[model samples]
Target: MKLLNDDLRNQLKEVFQDMKDDVTIAVFTKSGTCNTCTETISFMEEIETLSDKIHLKKLDIENDAELAKAYDVQMVPSIVLLNKDEAYVGIKFNGIPAGHEINSFIPGILEVSGSGEQLPEGFLKQLETVKKPVNIKVFVTLSCPHCPGAVQKAHKLALENEFINAEMIEAQTFDEISNKFNVSSVPKIVINDQYEFVGNQPLEVFVEEIQKTQA
Candidate 1:
């Protein structure tokens, strides 16, 4: 079954036309362990067909244990974006990029494909002050409409800052992880396991939350 229709495919092709570099979508999924693993692969395959610059590398955690560990993918249906240089930029999608999260996924590929930074000068300056390492885990569900904004913001920060890493944890697929974080709602932003907030926050508010991690 095809996930994208002809019209959507054309739109995506147009969106991807600006890609200056190739992007590799590294996916880790295990058969029988993840209910959405097969479908996620199919969805990525369809997206790959829309752009020449997009490549998909499918890896099963069970079979590719070492690679999975290297990427720190502890759950199934995990995806990480890498640039043409094969460098993992720390932009990760821990769940199936479905629903509103698809908005984040598409732009992630484009941003990773481009050369220059997507962030503004001020944002970069703020990130420079971040001396401590920050690990951000955004808990989301495919049905959540507001989750994409938080995920996109987290990903762009990860892309720009070497000391920060952001991951989108599918609340449903990684129930144990979600439970650990007490993610009862969608778009639960956890920073360094110390500071956390809910909902889609303004960029400044998000930055303030990140700053709180250093306190």
Candidate 2:
């Protein structure tokens, strides 16, 4: 059987072909036994095979410390997609941007790179003013029932909207983060390392706070 199905590869090709401007896929990876290092690199390389329009660049994190830092790559094997001179569109997939998700991933990249319809209302301004990164630390245990929706919203914002450093830290295991942030309550969202909001709020509220946090 094929590694990636034909449908996905076709969709990927179509999206890149539709882009009216240049697109760069910058990937940073370091050689080692680091978690998901090899798999991430391989997946990225496979991604390149699907598109000529995507200018793929790879750098070793440890060796290219300054470049990695410039891209805000705290973790290994992060992919940032760029369109011409616009600011970077960051991607942090837990495993791979493959399978069913790739169906949406390709178009999302193209749309973000400015090949689609009008900017959704506040999107352009949000893109311009968000110079500083918004750090969103979501604290939740693995088994928390209500946590996934909050986490999904945050992750969706990170993927579709290029404005925040959204991370879902496992509250049960990471005793240090839990204690430091005083996550006495589950689903606590810490924005910009300063503002801590408890429980799940509406998406609009999360978006508003993330915009403020970015500014």
Candidate 3:
């Protein structure tokens, strides 16, 4: 098993610590690659050791093909972070979430999952204009926790405005939207005909963009 160095371990520690509630670290692995797969499994075990709150579940791609398909995990050696009820925190690791990258993934999970619970006050000013129905398309993946928050925010606005049509385009399912919009990131939001907003923006900003679509 590969052990994380002191620096990386500390960083991953900070990430799990920020979790307001329990989190599940889903490790999706394939059996073929001797170097990458072996190292990834060992790395996840080390992460599992770091905390009891951060539970780890390993699944075989070959055996659990449908499981991987459901989450749209097209590649091996991916780490997905989930909240208490298995809500996504949008933490998807491609190669491995080790070293500097480890720090990035965990923090994102907390922030994305946390962002939707409460938005900032000033950010509300951003959502002042919603005059017409705009096809606010949000492209997401199951592994992304932040995507739900973004989707929730969109739904919130959808409830408020008659002219607003908010829809989520699962990137794995809606490959066209992903390719058309160049969706290389998680929780990417696009408004009307041209404007693009990535990440979970505050509700105010979302409202502001809705108004912009009228222009």
Q: Best by TM-score, which number?
A: 1
lDDT of candidate 3 over 31-71, digit per residue (tens): 76634667777877787777666677788777888766655
> RMSD in Å for candidate 3, one decimal?
8.4
- Per-residue alpha-carbon lDDT of model 2 for 1-215, expressed as tens digits? 24566886786677678777666766667677556557666777767787666666777878888877766666555555666774565533322344343433455456545675654567545545666776676677645666655655565566555556565555644557579999888778888888778877777667677767654
Q: Between candidates 1 and 3, name the one with more favorable TM-score.
A: 1
Residue range 52-143, candidate 1, lDDT tens digits: 88899999888999878777788888998989997887788987998878888988898899744567788888888988888889999989
TM-score against truth, every candidate: 0.93, 0.63, 0.52
**Index of the highest-lDDT prediction:** 1
Can you list the residue pairs that collide in candidate 2? none
Candidate 3 accuracy as lDDT = 0.63
Candidate 1 minimal-lDDT segment of 10 residues: 114-123
**Candidate 2: residue 140 Cα off by (Å):** 12
Better of 1 and 2 by TM-score: 1
lDDT of each: 0.87, 0.63, 0.63
Q: How should the candidates be ordered by lDDT, best one leading?
A: 1, 3, 2
